[model samples]
Target: MNLNIFRKQNVKTYLGEDIKFSRTLSAFDLIAMGVGAVIGTGIFILPGTVAATTAGPGVSLSFLVAAMICALAGMCYAEFASAIPVAGSAYSYGNIIYGEFTGWLMGWALILEYMLAVATVAAGWSSYFASFIKPFGLSLPKAISGPFDPKNGVYFDLVAVVVVVLIALLLAQGMKSSIKINNFAVILKIAIILIFIFVGLQFIKPSNYKPFLPYHMSGVIKGATTVFFAFLGFDVVSSSAAEVKKPQKNMPLGIIGTLAVAVVLYMGVSIVLTGMVNYTDLNVANPVAFALQYVHQNWVAELLSLGAMVGMATMMLTMIYSSSRLIYAMARDGLLPHHFSKFDKKHNSPQISLFVVTVVIALGSAFFSVNQLTNLVSFGTLFAFTLVSFGILRLRKRTDISNTGFKVPGYPVVPIISGLFCIFMMCQLNKDVFIMAAIWLVIGAIIYLVYGYHHSQLENKNSKAEEA
Candidate 1:
């Protein structure tokens, strides 16, 4: 063991270069991406489930708790994103502040987060798409509409495969074009959400909220942990720092704005949902739509089904984009093959990386069941959040580096709270999640030792300097 894999990146040198990505995204585009990433199955589904199982009518408070925890991490992300303005998000921050091995580990964990997230969301999207089209007397063959399971008589999820590939192609068209689609999906989803809120409000029963803390405050805290996964996508926003204009200014706004918007929407839906239907009766896969159906608003429920598909689609788009950028950043650092970093000059997109990610996601969504592995995604996300939160403390102490952009307020307090909360949430995960995550980390370590360590550009540069 050389034990020399801990060489840190020079932040000044990394940021001083003209990274190949085209800075075409405005603040609005960044915020839209963040919103698109964060507001998927979470708002449409988790409220009712958490309310029923954990906090009853107090799920609204759960959203607030989760949002506060996310904000702590979100502020840390904003600081690093604005200051670094790079593609790898936490991975890059880890490299600059920690070292090569740590960076590689963070990147590997993010790969799990983004890749599995895209697959899981696509699987969920397939169900919604099927349900959305079912009432119209249109349906895919049973065998082709779900994952391959001989016992279940399901062959493959063609809808999931098709949608993943379509989003991948959209991303291959580059950020400018793909963002338009994301923006459209986000607007449609939010409009449908607003429709649900306003329409559902007319049916609110004051009595439904009487037993607000049926499970007590502990349940509310548990509900916060349960719904914490809903806030996962906002971090993907920071992964786009390289492609944003005035990243220093826009990055913080995008990150903080995403959490702000998502929390408000989440709370609104939770309040209306619990008020419209008794919390005990709200536990269903499609809670928002079901709430409407309970109130005899079938038409609006139908509209919400459409919204669910759109919402999940937007999430897949953002996840795929973020995953590709992460790969590009890792490859650029020579942790992987340099070929993966090549961009299409015309479109300014990492077409090769996009293709690879698309294939994996399509295969996972179409052929494999990811329900059990979804918790792994949550664990990976919290792990990244914890590392990013602590990475800021290391970054701020370096006199050689300076960031005039965003800084975490209240100094060490915010990041300390952020990191500690993330760890607390991580502990809340099932034991199996930790086992799987440990296995994943071990595999990453083997790869790093065999390939990443030897191929690293920084290692090579350091060796040359030593020889001189």
Candidate 2:
């Protein structure tokens, strides 16, 4: 009943509550899931925004810059995920290495990022849906297409809602089915993107690359932060660490391999895009489709639209998967509740956690703008990455358990530099993002006091009850 009580727990007790997801994933499946979640949105969608607003032809460089920062974070995640082999991505590591209070806030920050991220991807999905619907002379109403908030000039987004519902159904079924679907989705989208790049390459004009950093010095920073969205899916690889057959070896391969593949594809597609058409002419939202149109490959644009629709669906699918697992880790440790953290015995999935995340994502997708949601996703990810980088240093000093696989080669220096890079990117997001982040942290603290603290495992409640 005391409001000012504090409790703490160690890793062993926390791991006891998990439903044993140890047999469901392989290195390939883990990598495929990362590819499935990350591949679609950034390359196919964000290049245009970078091209139009930041770097123009130099958006390719932006992709590389973002990838560099992620490369560091990815390695840190692979190391942590492999050692712990748990479902909670940064949140679990933060708790074990940093402390519970820090971990809770990280978990809370993640809810906004992933929830809005799903909504953002759903909005992107909606645009592609509208594009596909257009050929039949069918167009959805503006109000149905999106909410006219009037404040920002929009309120509801129907297409995003539809996408969220369909994906949630798939996710609620189980991780195995979700992984299988993601494998197919990732392959199909990659094939489609490759088609865009290969065909678009033959038509490159060279002039488009002339004034690359169109926005000047700051453009690189702008493009770097914007393109970070493309690099988003890498963390999902780490989230499934608990399920991997060989967490130590497989986690790194999946995280590193998936990110390497994505960055290459992003750069290739960016080059083909600007080469085929001047970056200035690209639609920030619909660049790839438009680039195909420039080469008289309008039919491919149609296919791109369809691929994109499917791509975003899978991204939302995996993102929701990651979110549920992270939250489940929190809840099983008494941060939320047994209900939110429970797993399905038959399906071997976090059904309750997944369902809660799905509802929040669906509602957000139905209401928010794409631009508004993108910042939300980016803001928290940078902070989480910074924590993971710092966790590497702390975990090393605190635990004598030598990591068996994917160690950060340089120890303190690698993580220190990575943490710095993460900070650099975090500062690049609009100043408003920091304000939103602060408010969320305050709310998380309030919940920790009123709920998580009392329910905590550290109190040895059963022993005390027997004595009473």
Candidate 3:
């Protein structure tokens, strides 16, 4: 087989291919999907944990920091999705501008992200659901309530698996049904967040914010790194470009609009949370509900927990949906088995790929603890975001393609800054995550060299007599 590291995919031809998707998602549905994905455990759970442990009252500033990074990266995504207007999100963008090798690796990293994201959020949902029902004495035993935690000795989280299976079945029905559920879930999540912010606001004590930066700038930055996971779901919107109506216009709208809404919601929650309860006491698993307990709003607290479980459901569904597309896209390119790309004629959904994703997510959620999976999710996303930031620069240098949709305002500066910010936040992550990511990338490399390199559709096309 010939070595072709720099072989680029043709976006126009790829878009023109017979591969069909039910293009039914409007900009609002895309935004709802993005919102559903972004506003999950990160908001309902992480704010209090980060505030108590790292940033204190200044955790709101951490949201601001992460939002800045997301805004820059989101702009780059908007440009790429608009210009390419295909499935596979960053992986597709990288393939068009960088090469097959880079694209393969990006898709591999994305698979890591989406899988871990579903697993982590599912586990989080289980814990919150358990907490919500414990007062009524309907909670499961320790053996089933949580996944395997070496310290706690719990094993096989039953709720997590059940949720993943249900979501998988829903996705198999098609995008239309899954997205309708997502829209409803998004509205519930936003309403719950608003309820928390407004209701908690009346109980805010000014003294709680006396030393807003109690943990200092380093702590704030650390908090920003931890909470960056909250801003991940918007990119999943881009992954659905092929199924979205008017991809060129609505893709940017969904990406940017989702980020704006997420930032405001996160910041508002952080302020109200710290003010309602002392930051030091907000480190529990159900932080929002824990804070609400102080104000004697047990019913609202229960509702918040219910909303969190629902929010995580949307996140899980979107992540699984996006990751399955990555598999389908790569399989269609012959990097994986062709059957993985096979879509149902009636539903236009990749049933086989969705099944594979569901199985992996269920297994991961059953065994891995949320803390163990969160770092992997964060590392993979930051790595993909870095590549996307760099890909924008490479795409702009190309003169062959007709560029359309939203363009990044500052060209090289925006992407350069976005790339640097991604790197900095990545550097702040635990070293173990880097090691794990490196190991995953190495495995992907091995598979590509042993199989994908030889069997790639592009290689086959290059050898065809007509092409010659």
Candidate 4:
């Protein structure tokens, strides 16, 4: 075993190089991007489904719990993004503070998070699209509307696959264009949410709150674990640190702002949604729009269904963009082929990585159901969040690192709680999720041993310097 795999990367050397990404993103742009990513299928679909299956009306409290966990992790992430300002997010942070092996695993886990997140959202988007068109008596063929379940009559999710490919094409146009589309989608998404809240408020029966804790506290905790997927996108903002202007100032604001906004929207929608309809009846794919239709607000429901599709498209765009950047960052570190590091100069994007990611996500969306994809995504994200929380504690002890960036408030206590909470959430996930994540990590370790260990750029650089 080459112990070089456990060697830490030099922070100063890593920070000193230009990574070739465009630095055109402002704090507002970063916020828009994060907001665009955070408020999609999680809000549109998960709230009602989680309520019906796990929390009942207690789903609102579940959102709060998930938000607090994310806040703890978000502060840790803010400190890292401000100080490192790199594209790899947790992968780069782990490399500098932990070691090559730990970094590789974090990057591997993030690959699962971003890729499956897009697939899960695409699956949700397909359902909303079906709902949106059905008002005109139009419908997708039964076999093409959902996943490949022979017993259920679903052969392949053609809509999900098509939407994923379209988002990939849009991202290939580059960051600036994608951000513009994200901003527009975010504004429309927010407007639709507000309309749902106010309009749905008038229809609340007040009876839905009776059995709020129908499944008890255990169910609330379970719902928090399940809906944790709603909070996954805030970290994607950290992945954009390399592209932001004055990242030291903007990164923290963007990351924290994203969580703050998303939490409020999630809680408000969860409450109004459960209030307007019985939790048992809210388990359908297009929950938000369905609530309005239940109250005889058909026109509003149709409009909301359209907005949901637009909202999810932005989420897919941000996830795909973030995933490609992670691949680029890992390749730049010699953990993968250097060819993956090449940017399309004309577009200022990683076109090759985008293509590879698009294929994987499209396939996942076409074959897997949303529920299967969602749990796996939550597990991958929690795994990364756990590493980042503890990685910050180690970073604080380094004498060579600068103290100029944002620091997690309350220091050791905050990060400790953050790390423990992530583990607790992981425990709350399905046992099947545990099995799948273990398999994923085992595959990652094999790749590291075969290729990354031999071709490591840092190892080669250090060996050459020693000979001199």
How many steric clashes between backbone atoms does each model show? Answer: 0, 7, 0, 0
Best by TM-score: 1
What are the lDDT scores of the predictions, listed in order?
Answer: 0.89, 0.79, 0.86, 0.86
User: What TM-score goes with each of the models?
Assistant: 0.96, 0.90, 0.93, 0.91
Measured on C-alpha atoms, candidate 1 has an lDDT of 0.89
TM-score attained by model 4: 0.91
lDDT string, candidate 3, 1-468, tens digits: 667776877665457542498789899998898888888766878889999999999999999998988999999999988888888888888887888889989999999888988888888778777877878988687877776776786878999999999999999999998888889988988998899898999999989997999989999998888888789878999999999888889999999999999999999999999999889889897788888888899888878877878888988888899989989888878889889989889888888988998999899889876676578877888888999998888888888666677999998899999999999888888888888899999999898888887777874543452343
Q: Give the Cα RMSD of candidate 4.
A: 2.9
Off by over 4 Å in 4: 49-56, 137-157, 205-222, 278-287, 367-370, 460-468
Off by over 4 Å in 3: 139-155, 215-219, 459-468
Query: What is the C-alpha lDDT profile of model 2 across 80-114, one tens digit per residue?
Result: 88777777888778777777778877778887777
Give model 2's TM-score versus the native structure: 0.90
